[model samples]
Target: MLTKRLFSSSSASPNLFKIGSILKQTRTFTDADVLGYSELTHDANPLHFDAECAKDAGFNDRLVPGMLVASLFPRIIAAHFPGAIYVSQTLHFKLPVYIGEEIIAEVQATSIRRMKNKYIAKLSTKCIKCNGPLVIDGEATAMLPSLVIEPPNLASASS
Candidate 1:
C-alpha cells in the first residue's frame, strides 16, 4: 500500500531524521523565475518563455519548466534538514505548471536507515498547486550528516 501525506515546514524537527517526517514549502513560479532559469540553463523552449507559443500549444499561459518546478524539493530539504546531503533524486512530471501559480512542494521521510556511520533518508516528494493537481511526483535520497561529538581536550584547555 502507498501512503500520501502533506506536511508543513514546522511539522518536523530539524536534524531529526525520523521515518514519516515531512517537510513542505510553497513558491510561485513567476515569469522572472522562468526567465532567470532560462538564462542560467540556456533552455529557450517556447512553451516556457513565449506566451503565444504556449497558447498555441493549448495552455492557458506560459508553462514553467519541469526542472524549475522540481527545484523546490531541495529547498524543503535544506530548510527542514540542515546538513543533509542530497545523494539522488527522481522526478516524474504529471502536469504543466503555468507561470504565476503558487505550488506546494512536499517531502516526506518514508524510510530512515543507518549506513556505516551516517543515516540515509529515503523521501517521497511531490508538488501540487492550490487547485489540487499534482504537477510533479518524485523521490529523493539524502544522507544525513554525522551526529558524532568529539571529546573535550582538557589538557589543551589548561595549557
Candidate 2:
C-alpha cells in the first residue's frame, strides 16, 4: 500500500511535533531511481547493476543500495519539518531490498530537546518491505528551526 502526505512550510513548527509523533512515506524503487542514484553517487557495485551477479550473491535480482533506501528518512523529515537540519544518523541493514519492491519509510520522534533557540529531535527510523520484513533499522537526530515570533509592531499599533 502506497501513501503520501503533503506538509507545507507555513504550517510547520518545531513546537507542533512532540514525543512519539510519527510520519510514514512509501515508495517503490525503480530502475530509473537506481540509475540516477548511481550516476549521481558513482555507486557502481555489480550487485546493483548485474542481475547475474546479484543471483550469485544470493539475491533474486539487482539489489538496491542500502544508503539509497535509507535516504527516505531524511527526505521524510525534511518534507515534514521544512527547515530541519540533519545532525546524525545510524543505520543497520538487516535485509536486502530489490528493485521494484515497495518499501515504507517511517520516522518517529523518540525525544525532543530544547536548546535555547533550537529544538533537537531524536528519532527512530526504519524501512520495511510491504508485507515482507524490516529491511533497515536506524536512528537519526535533527535540529528543527526555532519558532520565531515577531514582537507586535509598536509603530503600527500606535498608527
**Winning candidate number (lDDT):** 2
Clash total of candidate 2: 0
| Candidate 2 residue-wise lDDT, 1-159, digit = tens | 232222324345533566656677788999999999999999899999999999998989999999999999888777666677999999999999999999988888777777656777788999999996999998999987742312222211000
lDDT for residue 97 in candidate 2, whole number 0-100: 94
Lowest summed lDDT across 10 adjacent residues in model 2 is found at 150-159
**Highest-TM-score candidate:** 2
- The CA lDDT at 80 in model 2 is 65
Distance (Å) between predicted and true CA of 138, model 1?
1.2
lDDT of 1 by residue, 13-130 (tens): 4544456655667788788899999999999999987889999998898899999899888766665545779999999999889888889888877876676656677889999998
